[model samples]
Target: MALKPLGFYQRLQQLTLPAQQAFMAALCERQLPNYALYAQTTGCGDTHALKAVLDLVWEQLSVRGASIDFARQAEKLVECEPPADDDSFGARRALDVVVSLFSLLDTLRGEAPEAVLDVSRTSRAGVRAFIELTEGEEDAQRLALLIRDHPLTDDENGFQDAVLDAVSQPLNKALLKDVRRLGKNDGVSNLGLSLE
Candidate 1:
């Protein structure tokens, strides 16, 4: 059976963990090793690890939604240390992954308001903890600064493209191709549902 075109929000909700992970892998420019680490660390057993991360993101969004200061949360994100077992490059580029995730979420904000709010509702602490586990070396910090400085584009495609352009890694580019493919009218059918 083939998956049909549902809107982004609906599609997101309908996707299984492996599918969601593939979506995230494409969206976040993640490679296999790091992707596995994220899955393992975040507990991708019955659920998507990124979904849990989204919940943490929702926590920050909720605070921001209240028209309050969320700088403290941002500060905490930078302070986090990557997990020791994660020699994965994804851990090294954790900041980039996070920025991409937030950018992607922000793009779909209007179309999936309830999911956004609900997903973002989980405590920021979990995401923050994950951020810490990422490699926070100087290069990662510098890239993070670049991401932070760049303005988020108005449209989803534009934002995704801009992020992809900003990070010139082969894996990221490959994954983004999938991301773009998934965003199209009948993109869902193209997804590689099996977990790697």
Candidate 2:
């Protein structure tokens, strides 16, 4: 049976592939290995395992009618550690944003929870970042800086470089492919995730 396209589903399908990929890639880079980084983060506000927090965010928001405010959503994203306040700020900031993201995902998943995994770019950036950070290569960071310089152009080989570089990671294959798939199918909704 064919399912009708949901409104939000239509929007998700419409996002530009490169733009979405870049955003997802950046978001993925900021993730932590676990909550352990929290206490160790000290003033960086790394309290609580990051992955755990993200998990919590997911759990809390998978309810009905939940959604995030897109305007603040991007700014509210946790990219830096929280400032000192006797309590850990980084974890708090991360958690807060996750709460919003959770709502967003929940709203999106309301119609099709299963599709979430099949089409999620949420973890894309974190996975890539984890590899780069773990590898601890100067080139990785340099490449990131270069990306900043060359925004939205696949011609510079930067986007190609990103895919090639991240290809080594297990998660990157799906993430990159999904990004490309998303771009191509912009504005079109398929009942199944299949591109064709």
Candidate 3:
């Protein structure tokens, strides 16, 4: 979303309760496509929008004691939505976007819930992934830490090395590229939201 006109994504970072409630009303009605389009054109964070949309969907279903099926729902909303050119490339591209959105929201669960809620725009599976991670034991934490300690952007396997060399803070050069690059001034606009 930040790559698009992500104003809403940024606003979500500081969204008010009343604003959230009001948005939820519209979002719950499955009218999120409009807002999603707006967010996309604005080059904002899709992650933020997906999170909100997912949350609204979860609330509606959970409140009604409904069965939640993210995979089936993902197919209906995204998979079956044929691309404009009837090309598989577009389908793959769209699927990639959905996957990216889900992955990002899953990452943000570590953030403050309010802040995360404002910036996330994930689906049920994404949220459930986040929830599951939160419920993990030391094993999970250790695995995540391992990933954070390493990235694939350094050495011969700079990216591979980083992931294998995962460590705690005091991030090393091997993992420098593994961390957030959005904050850097590399003569290119950084998204600044890589996995940490």
What would you estimate as the lDDT of candidate 2? 0.36
- TM-scores of all predicted structures: 0.26, 0.26, 0.23
Judged by lDDT, which candidate is best?
A: 1
Please report how far candidate 3 places residue 196 from its true position, in Å.
48
Candidate rank order under TM-score: 2, 1, 3
How would you encode candidate 1's per-residue C-alpha lDDT over 1-196 as one tens digit per residue? 9978565455454544323333433444322223335445664321244434544533432233443233433344333335556565445434334444544444333243333223222212223333344434356676455334432212333433343333233333344444544433132111111233
Can you tell me which runs of candidate 3 are displaced by over 4 Å? 1-9, 16-67, 87-196
What's the residue-level lDDT of 94 in candidate 1? 43
Ranking the candidates on lDDT from highest down gives 1, 2, 3
Give the Cα-based TM-score of candidate 1 against the true structure: 0.26
Error of 3 at 177 (Å): 45
Question: lDDT per model, in order?
Answer: 0.37, 0.36, 0.34
Best prediction by TM-score: 2
Off by over 4 Å in 2: 1-36, 39-119, 140-196
The weakest ten consecutive residues by lDDT in model 1 span 185-194
